[model samples]
Target: MMINNARHSYVCPNCHSALEFQTKQVVCQNCKNTFPIDEYIPDFLLTNQEDGGEKLKNRASRFDDLSKVYESSNWGGSPRIVVWLLTRKIRYKAGIGLDVACGTGVVARSMAKKINYVYGVDISMGMVQKAFDLSQKNTINNISFARCDSENLPFGDNFFDFVSCSGALHAFPNAEKALKEMQRVLKTGGVLTIMALLQKNIHSVIDPTKRELKKSSTDEEIIEFNKAHSSMENLDVKLHRFTLAELKMITKKIGFNNFKYLKLGSVLIFSVER
Candidate 1:
């Protein structure tokens, strides 16, 4: 697989500066921070303070470990359903697309068929590597993968014609920031589609015992129970289950309009025009 020079599509994820593409690395023109290119995929993952701290790193590590079996795993919901909902409204045939938190590139690859080009980004290197590998093995030339945070995208503002995030919004540490970043990069009137878990019940899915405790315990007891079960917490980052109403409210507040959604079981697939 040859490297497609998509350098013009990226900016410094840290400082939003221009980048100088080299043979094996990309250098930020303003911050002077450098990122490496491995096997034709650029690595734009920030570290320490710039990387959303330790919790985000842990989440990325978790996905990294899951990358090997992610395609065959049930963790990511039905890809065919997700792709259908996401591309239902897309009519453009020659525009740029972005897939955020693109685990294993299912949505990204599907999106590539509708758009002229697509860029798939994920925080986990393992996931990005797998995405790139699959694209290469299948001879997909118009799509590329990068390791970058969703909250701080490595692209310029209003650069994408369509943006889609499927089944991974709830796992983001700050969902609002991620949404805002998606909006920022999207061109005016661009489409944004997202699929996430709907918060239906007050009982915790992470810890089902909380439901039993909530029935008879006081507020203090709930707090105590949380502390005791803290070690059992998976993903470390708080998993936010968003209700449809909440999703509408937040996305509207962030400047997205024409909201529409379809509910399939507990998963909510929604689309909005920018």
Candidate 2:
């Protein structure tokens, strides 16, 4: 299937109006809000700095720092199986898809090669930029990147055939809101897949290390950490643990049915039809 490279699939976050594509930006004709295109990626974050600005900035900065090492890393094992599963779930190969919080576009790139065209959205400008750069370097044209909030996607309702959020749900500020946005953009009968890090994995791998560290820590070291950072409040990626039951409750409440899930090592995969 041929895609129109000139035409964009986006809407204004402020007014839900169609955006006109220009050379360096996409403008909303109705609201007259201009979203600048930096480094060839259209940015859709319209909220002011006061409204969750620091949180957004901190998330962006954290992922930006991760982008430096993202390409070299294996991205937590093979994503080929994930892409294969998604491609099989998709009814056809002609429709467009969305990848939310697509850090470095690993899964998006694989999906672009296997199935349909893809649009990858990330909160971090650095991650989006790296995704674009990698796409360009590899000559992959079917996938595009945008800087946007996952909790509030800037797209029309029922616009996507499939949506995939992999290994990033636990880090979202509001996981339920993000899931709702995913449901809102999905077409009826469309598939939504979320891959998250399970709490069991953390207990197995991380808890023992923490216990050892705590056993060895001096009183001064503990006091200094408490004085400087206080609680673990400012941690960039706070892993919000979830169980299978909790996931089922959220998915069912959001109007999704035909639920299916699987555990792939530390990653918990959930696939539901909207």
Candidate 3:
């Protein structure tokens, strides 16, 4: 496989300032923080669990987004299979690709051979740990799972050649901002494929009463949950719920070329090039 991971000069993970490399380690001359590079890739903020959401332990995922296709038994790998099914026709092999909100590298493990240097970034520790375990089991050395947020990725601009975000946009506080960042990391001719739930009256897809009841957990229970605030308000006000016209406007705004949109299940598959 072609080595696509950049060994470019790095910056402070904390402040994002230029860093000085010393003895296989990069240290922030300003922040005085240090990061080690094991097997060539710098472990910049790799161990930070702050990016990890609540560790779900062994309990089943109650609100799993991929429940329709994947059962409680399959875990993250199942969702990865779904992504492959959606975009198998497009060329992804040996291309640098990112699986955002890549919970436990489920979709990523399946995509490792299809892409070079698959970078799986997610905020959930439980997911990251699960992904890490799978990567080790599969011995997929080129795949790197980082504890990172979609809103604030550690990568530089124009880095990856391809990106895939499956069933992730709905969880974002600002989907448009996240989309722009995904676009920013891609090279001029790079490709992006995102799968997200259509906001067109979600009740039409999910039962209205069931969805509403899930939102009203007890106050004591709220403290236990990681995502306490609901993004429905933000979705209601600022979200561009995917009409064909709106989807076209978004891809245009994101600087994508030859954009195309397709519906898969209740999710919209936005495929475009940079």
Poorest 10 consecutive residues by lDDT, candidate 3:
67-76
> All models: lDDT?
0.81, 0.75, 0.59
Q: Total clashes, candidate 2?
A: 0
Candidate 1 residue-wise lDDT, 100-176, digit = tens: 99988989888888898999999988889999888888888899899889998999999999999987888788899
Give the TM-score of each candidate. Answer: 0.84, 0.82, 0.64
lDDT of 2: 0.75
TM-score of 3: 0.64
Pick the TM-score winner: 1
Candidate structures ordered by TM-score, highest first: 1, 2, 3
Clashing residue pairs in candidate 3 are 76-106, 80-107, 93-114
Candidate structures ordered by lDDT, highest first? 1, 2, 3
Candidate 2 global TM-score: 0.82
